[model samples]
Target: MAKADGLDLIAVGRSCVDLYGEQTGGRLEDMLSFAKYIGGSPTNTAVGASRLGLDAGLLTRVGEDHFGRFIREQLAREGVDTRGVVADPARLTALAFLGIRDPDTFPLVFYRENCADMALEAGDIDPAFVASARAVLINGTHLSQPGVFAASMEACRLARAAGGKVVFDIDYRPVLWGLAGKDAGENRFVADAAVTARLQQVLPLCDLIVGTEEEVHILGGSTDTIDALRAIRERTPALLVCKRGAQGCSAFADAIPDSLDQGVVGRGFAVEVFNVLGAGDAFMAGFLRGWLRGAPLAECCEWANACGAIVVSRHGCSPAMPTWEELQAFLRDEARPFRLREDAALEHLHWATTRATGYPSLTVLAMDHRSQFEALCERTGAAPERIAGFKSLALRAVDRVAAGDPGFGVLLDGRFGMRALEAAAAYPYWIGRPIELPGSRPLEFESSADVATELATWPANHVVKCLALYHPDDPQELRERQERQLLRLQDAARKTRHELLVEIIASRGGEVAEDTAARAIERLYALGIRPDWWKLEPDDRAGAWRGIEDAIVRNDPHCRGVVLLGLSAPQDELIASFAAAAQAPIVKGFAVGRTIFADAAEQWFAGTIDDEAAIDDLARRFAILVEAWRDAKQRAQTQAIRETA
Candidate 1:
């Protein structure tokens, strides 16, 4: 048999039309804004491999609808071989509505009933392609349907017969596999016994297994990786690799393999994240890239980590991947020191290096810039107010300081320019400071100080956000000027009275326990400047505040209460405790991005003239606190009255 040329990889499974939208922050009641895009694990994997300069192919069924056409076009554009991509005129394509409440893990709403993709039969997978490829990837979702399931098992049988490597991604959608043949009931949930049995049946045929921590626990019945590995080992000799999102991954190749004496644990790349939708596919692509090049298992795992990091730091899965040249550049530049000031600059550098290495679409940049909010709103068609509410939550969690706002100023890293500022500005309630849009300068501050001096004045209450790089086509001189401005802003943040909160939107969290939020705090701390608050958005559900509580406890510092930007969490007690611990008043800020301050005086401060008396009374109460903090004699009496009132 001829060894596969240029790393032939065949990814077989679901091909879908995905409509993804996320609230600017995670809130269910918030109007969900979103965008539609094509997404599926195996299809994405194929695209990723092709982007890495490998000969990758996708094998799945799609309806002969516009969505199907779009999927084919995307695959072709990405240079993936789609000869085996079947279009069924008889059935509708699988459509999934994904709501990414958190940037890390998202719950999906899938509409897939005998869907076109699930209509795949073994005959649809060409034997020649399987024989030609070195590895074949399959999804458990496809196997949920008996025909597709039989087809995949048969394909694996043939691939094994032909000596090809077989990989299984246990993309277990609990909602999708509910009760197999049983009626939809409590006992018939997809994650029930039936699905577990199906998973067990398929594991023996796979040489490698990739799954989420939850999937592992469900299928293997253990939380411990070692025990899970043992459970998997008993079913199949396939190497077990558990993808643990931020915690990194662990692979058990033993009883023992050459790669590790006992087992292999690979730490994921620490990245500033935007969305984690397709990082898993990116990881698969990276792992294949390394494997094809005869890279050590450890190195393969590193490739996966780096690829996943790159994807999360950017936006959607396939769109955010780095080209081969870009990947090399990032690897080469890993050791280089980051300019102390640019927070998201390092991630941009990573993307830049990856872009230099291979071809990536400009759409990726656009997606990264705005997909999180835009996509969510479109999907949910959420009421505008709800959308604003959710966005405020995300903004509060992230707490991005804007440049022109009265409370705080952001350091503008010129990379995203006005677009970044505008995005921040759109938030109705956030720390987004106003930025002089491109070609616009701070005229108000022009009379009082120089640009740097003016920029620093907002330091006490402002976060200076800077985009360190300019348009990709900008002249080197222009780019250098932007970098210099970033440096100036950094310096200003340090000396000014304001807390410097830098948003490195592209960073990733690794094994260092410094996840994006932690890293953001750490980055500023390393600069010898302490931020009054490190912002973040927790999950959108009722108990989302727990995450903030955990982060606060983990990264204890001289930080105040988090400026919560959304509705009261169901777990208000936990959040209140955090507020008490931080000794910082939890401001019920809006989640409308940077737009929050446009009418800040009216909404947050003024309200209406008719209520002026009440507002005045509230103001007087605050005055007493300020006075009490200053004067001891009247302090006690004022405090007592205020508390009683």
Candidate 2:
């Protein structure tokens, strides 16, 4: 039986990579580009459930390859537990090529010869793990093959023995069962008595059964929908759900209804269908979300229908599933558009919620200084052109310090550091480029007033770092101007699909309260500006850091936590700040500049140190800060563990 704190659901079978053609209303042969996403019936359901706030796990096998690792990592990012997801050394992961030919026709081709997922054996089913979930869901495709069928049946037996419900999704794929040609991946139904008999053998063990109209027809071995329901009911007393496409879904608990309209019906939403590939999987996920919580049948069907509606109007499968917050907002808003894809607010919500990279910590080298570098060159009697070469050398130092560490990043400007930025683009490091004009009090863009047009030319990996010299106590007109500029930048970042990092320096406006920075952040939130990252001046006081953390969490929990910025503070002072900020979990890492680079730059400009010597010195200094930041984080973690103990 499932323990009180065990997982909510475990989905077994069919994990694959889906390469969806980007061009709509085009055949697969004519498509030019494709967007990759994790797919497969059970995998999509697991991702959908996790996104909708369920403690979901996936039980499947992926090959030992790049795509396999990608599938596992993506699943973890979506909050699905992957303990049961095995990596097979013998086979390759499956791939599905799909194109949206039109609203109704989606061409699909599966490259599944000797795929790892289909090689699942009964021995792979861990009884304890199977019992750890309150419900175990197995799709019909797994039962089409002998080895996977054994594994699926074993999971069902273990789940039932441990008092867990078994959920059956008649995920009928005719090509998978060899009833159709290899190219007929989109073929939903193909009547074969043998396939129906095989499905009937597993139907009696299910506690709940869900399928589209065509799927139920195959399961019940009948051409009629009502007749299929009756046939399926005789085998088991499971709660049967019939997916009626645009008409929503119908549920039957006690008896098979004479007609679907007579049963408990959940009305569907009015939305244009873009692609119907993974809609059923999404519907099952939404239904399970409510059913596991003991919600009413009508409520479960409502979520299911809404989820289906939303996915059908969007592009990819798992990526299209709505988060719990998005789902609730859509349900609550009476003015939502009939075509969900046309709703800008909902689209932004979906994009923001679903597309965050998993960067736990970032140690950045902030050398985006323009005026300072030029001034140093002038003071040393060196040509202004030397500044560009110096920025490139600084990038080399960054490369040395951040070699294999994905957590390291660089903040470079395009004016003098364009060469460095171009070189840094080749690496997988977190690259941020400054958008705010240097030391601009009202936050003016360096290139143009139109931020979106400027952002369109930037590489996708470069984060938009805008340093806002903001203060809550500023004169109303000045503060509003700065806020307006920030709002424009935020919108531009969203449109360009670039992450925005708003660096707040509240002290720039003069003497202020300890909570001044936090207040400025709160003011921005009030103006509907939600940055993906917040770069703030580090405070040595724990209370000040906590205030900033509280504001960020209260406003946008999805906002990537803050990174401390150095305002040319001495190395010792920066380290001290790290210790203080480390105590706040919201402070991720530091983006320090002058403390590591000023002395090196000055020496190199004055001919006191050669390029090699300067690079080595800068690398050493940056490494020291990285080590100090890590030590402080370790200490903070230890103290937290001690407190909890």
Candidate 3:
């Protein structure tokens, strides 16, 4: 089979940031924290489609600010093409502050007055790119404004001219339409002929039209749902899908006959609704996922209902769309009620897995050691105060590498590198912080789950890097103690919404450290401690990493792939280890510390080199390691391609 061309689906219109209240059944004022997720109808649909292995792209505008960068990065991380998305320097990115009181009602505030996405002009769109997609999906909110309306029409014209299907999701928000103000309720009903005419103008261009009952009523220029469906069908020879919330949905087409009352209604999944924020978008994506793959209407509707069911039972919008494996598993099991975050099965679905789009591999700089770094400095007769300074030098090196955009992460400790932690989190680089007490053997900590307090407040995107030194042949009592301590951290991770990155290193006296490290992960899995990421000691042989990979796959396929740790190894030895790791697909990245910055740290601490010299040296060494890893990964890919040929 020939390789497929990219951009099968292009979604246009509004894209915004959603700040969802973390605490349920509370007023927005009372909620102390909120989780951030990408929001907006068309954006969510694009992300959902991408999650189902579709080549999706987005066309919108975001502010040239932090939020805008976040929107772009998040979309790109999901494999959504963001080249068509523009960064409007003049306007701020749109934001929605939302709270859920119950299953029936969700209070939402649109902070999108003259926002960037709405500022999208006809000139902002690329006609060729719009025409390239097999289907162009557009939301109705863009029709409310002159500039966005013109752009949406141009896109429709381009897609239709190129023999591409135009899909219209009647995403009618009264507040978005300016028919209702910020406080006039999130869900509003308004029937206006002018709005209907505006929508009807593009009906002939659409091959598929999807809308809820109220949305259909508004666009069809009718008060009744049945009449709304008939009116829409009369105008366009498109397939009409009317979503009826818990009653499932009905799809009507000219070929389906008019004698039927509601047409072909897809059976709905009776999930205990958590929040119905993105169900419609999920439904559209699921329908497209099946339809694009040549499935029949009934099967397409099944996928749509399942996708909607999973999202409504979760917290966030776009991020809550289930992966392909997750959807299959959810559909396969006919078990009891599944709760989000509370149930292990549902929690492992990985709705928030950050897949690489432009850059899949990460070259992490691990400078998080507190006790170890202090000890090394003390032995060299360097001032203790230089620990933070050494960390700062390492951070500067990280900054230089991040500028180039082959993914990178920084691991730091709170004792000295807290400033670096705060700084790195703001950038696109992945941020990780050590949770273990300084130099704890057998995984002992100063207090029981002290990191839990910090974990609760830490941003969700950042990783909690916890280290534990364990020996496979250790005494029973010591082994039991370590397991219990790890269990505490695991429980804390579950409660605090932090993705745990556990670093497992074997005790020095063990048999072949790599084998010991592989077994350690299996032991952790057996103890029911499944982390999102594993930081393992580098292996000398490529095949030696296979056991570790197998253990991770068995424990949690959703587990983010492992990263190779430096283990304070010599530069040449560490480079060899990284070369070996590059051959394993499961080793997603490397977290080499001493190999990248040890000499520079020593020189800076001993006052042999100035801060700038130390920083430049660290950057030099880090870059060399990065180049080595990239070369190895490239060679491995080439070998695989040759083998296939």
Candidate lDDT values, in order: 0.54, 0.90, 0.81
Candidates 1 and 3, the one with greater TM-score: 3
lDDT of 1 by residue, 273-297 (tens): 6667788888888888877667788
Clashing pairs in 3: none
lDDT of 3 at 418: 69
Off by over 4 Å in 2: 1-5, 181-183, 342-345, 355-363, 367-409, 412-462, 466-498, 503-529, 536-557, 567-589, 602-645
lDDT of 1 at 153: 88
List clash counts for every candidate, in order: 73, 1, 0
- lDDT string for model 2 (353-437, tens) is 8865667889999989999988898899988888888889988898898886879889999999999999996777888999988
Q: What global local distance difference test value does model 3 have?
A: 0.81
Clashes of 3: 0
User: Which candidate leads the pack in TM-score?
Assistant: 3
RMSD of each: 22.4, 5.3, 3.9
User: Once model 2 is optimally superposed onto the true structure by TM-score, how far is the C-alpha of residue 321 displaced, in angstroms?
Assistant: 1.6
Candidate 2 to native Cα RMSD, angstroms = 5.3
Q: What is the C-alpha lDDT profile of model 3 across 1-645, one tens digit per residue?
A: 101554779999989999999889977778878888889999999999988878899999999999999999889878899989999999999999888888777889899888999998889888778867888998889998888888999998998888788999989888777777677547757777888888888898899998888999899898777777778878899988878787777777664454334477666677788989988899999999887777888778888988898889888889888777777777787773756445566655653353343226778998888777878877889877778767876777888867846488788877788677776665777778877876677676543447577677677767788888776667788888888888988888876777788887774536765467667888888888888788888787766787788788877776778888888888888877776777778788888887777787777777788988988898888888888888888887888799999
